[model samples]
Target: MEQATLQTPLGMATILGDRNGIRAIRVTDHSEGEDSIPPALAEACGQLREYFNGERTVFDLPLAPEGTDFQQTVWQALLGIPYGKTISYMDLAKQLGDPAAIRAVAAANGKNPLWIVIPCHRVIGSDGSLTGYAGGIHRKKWLLNHESANPQQSLF
Candidate 1:
């Protein structure tokens, strides 16, 4: 699979994938000069740049996230979430027609390989608190705020 590093308002993120589709996009602490945006990853990198620039809300690209059936279902459901909206894990569980699977749903959410594209940051705690985020709570908050804000402020 090909890999590339993109610099966003949140930080430097490494996007991994190939012709199959984007598999993962994770923030890393690597230095700036090492970016390697290949053709397969250029679209993703550009879209992510647009996202940070507040010019995009929905993502339209091939995806190939690796996960279990349940996890894949959860991730697909996450894609249905609107850009500026938020949902509680419990609500997500109920949406799946299994309120008892709240924990399982949350676990699946946590395992999402694609970051902003999957919009896992849109999910929060039942009490409306910003809960756990693989990318860090601050980034989650920033993403939610970015999506919700109007006038499309530039974070770069």
Candidate 2:
């Protein structure tokens, strides 16, 4: 696996991947030792740059995040959420055919490793409040607002 850290409006963005596919995209406060920019991560970096620049609303990169089957299912559902749209945990669970799975779905959403690519930031609390995000709620809000300001028609 190789990695690269990029500068974004929120902070440093790190992408980890290999020939298999991208494994994760982590946001952090620093990028000291993360400057290598391996060839395998180039496509992901370019897509992310387009996303942050509001030129790309939909991502078309291969993802290989390590997680349980249930987590993978939740993450895939998250990908279905349109850019600039939000969904409650309950809604997501219901879409999964089990409204009682709200907690579980939210847990998996929190564990999403692909950051903006997986779009875990698009999930919000039932009452419309921003909730737990690995990248911080402030960053979540920023991402949501960013997508909102640049809404695109849903292809689904």
Candidate 3:
């Protein structure tokens, strides 16, 4: 698998994938040395940069995140969430046809590896509050604020 690390405004982010598609995009401590970036990873980095710059809202890159069938299902549902919108965990579970699966859905959501790419940050608490996030609540707030202020616009 190929990998590339970037210093995003939020922090350091690493992209990992191969010819299949992008597998993961996670924030991590800065890694040493400059690794050669694969084409797909390069493209992912560019798009992420555009996203941070507020010049882009929607992403159109191939993704191949690794997870279980259930987790995969939850991740796919997350993608369906429109840009600049937020949904509660209960709402997400209901969308998956199992309102009782809120906890399970939250667990799967927590395991999302694609980070900003999968748009997991769009998920929030049922109380309309920003909750747990692997990238920290501060980053989550930033992402939500960013999206709310810079929603996708039609080219037409």
Candidate 4:
């Protein structure tokens, strides 16, 4: 596994990846040292910078998130969410064909590791309020605002 951290307007983000793909991207309070950047980490950082600069929409990188089968299914479902769109947890549950699993869907969403790439920030409360995000609600709002301001030209 390789790791690198970058400071963004929202906060410091730590990205972990391997030759297979990016595994995780999470916000952390600590800043990483210059020497800590691996070659793959540099590529990931560059992509993230491009994203923040509004030059990139979809990410082109490998992703290998570690999670259970159900968690992986939920995270994969998140990839279907459009860049500027938002979905309720209940909606996601229904999409999964399990309306009774709203809490389970929310739990799986909370466990998503690939943050922006998976687009977990697109999930919101049924009442249209921003809900829990591991990265922080402020960052979640920032991501949503960013996407809304710079809508993607093409989803694919």
Using lDDT, give the best candidate's number. Answer: 1
Residue 58 error for model 3, in Å? 1.2
Q: In candidate 2, which residue ranges exceed 4 Å CA deviation?
A: 31-34, 150-156
TM per model? 0.93, 0.92, 0.90, 0.89
Question: What is candidate 4's lDDT per residue for 1-156, written digit by digit as tens?
Answer: 888887867768888887778999888666655346788677778889899988888887878999999899999999999878999999999999999999999999999998788898999999999999988897898899899966445457
**How high is the CA lDDT of each candidate model?**
0.91, 0.90, 0.89, 0.86
Sort the candidates on TM-score, descending order: 1, 2, 3, 4
lDDT of 3 by residue, 1-24 (tens): 888988887878888998789998
Q: Supply candidate 3's per-residue lDDT for 148.
A: 92
Cα lDDT tens digits for candidate 1, 55-104: 99999999999999999999999999998999999999999999999999
Residue 146 local lDDT, model 1 = 85
Which rank order by lDDT, best down to worst?
1, 2, 3, 4
Model 4 quality (TM-score): 0.89
Which candidate number maximizes TM-score? 1
Cα-based lDDT at residue 128, candidate 4? 98
Clashes of each: 0, 0, 0, 2
User: RMSD in Å for candidate 4, one decimal?
Assistant: 5.1
Among all windows of 10 consecutive residues in model 1, the one with the lowest summed lDDT is: 28-37
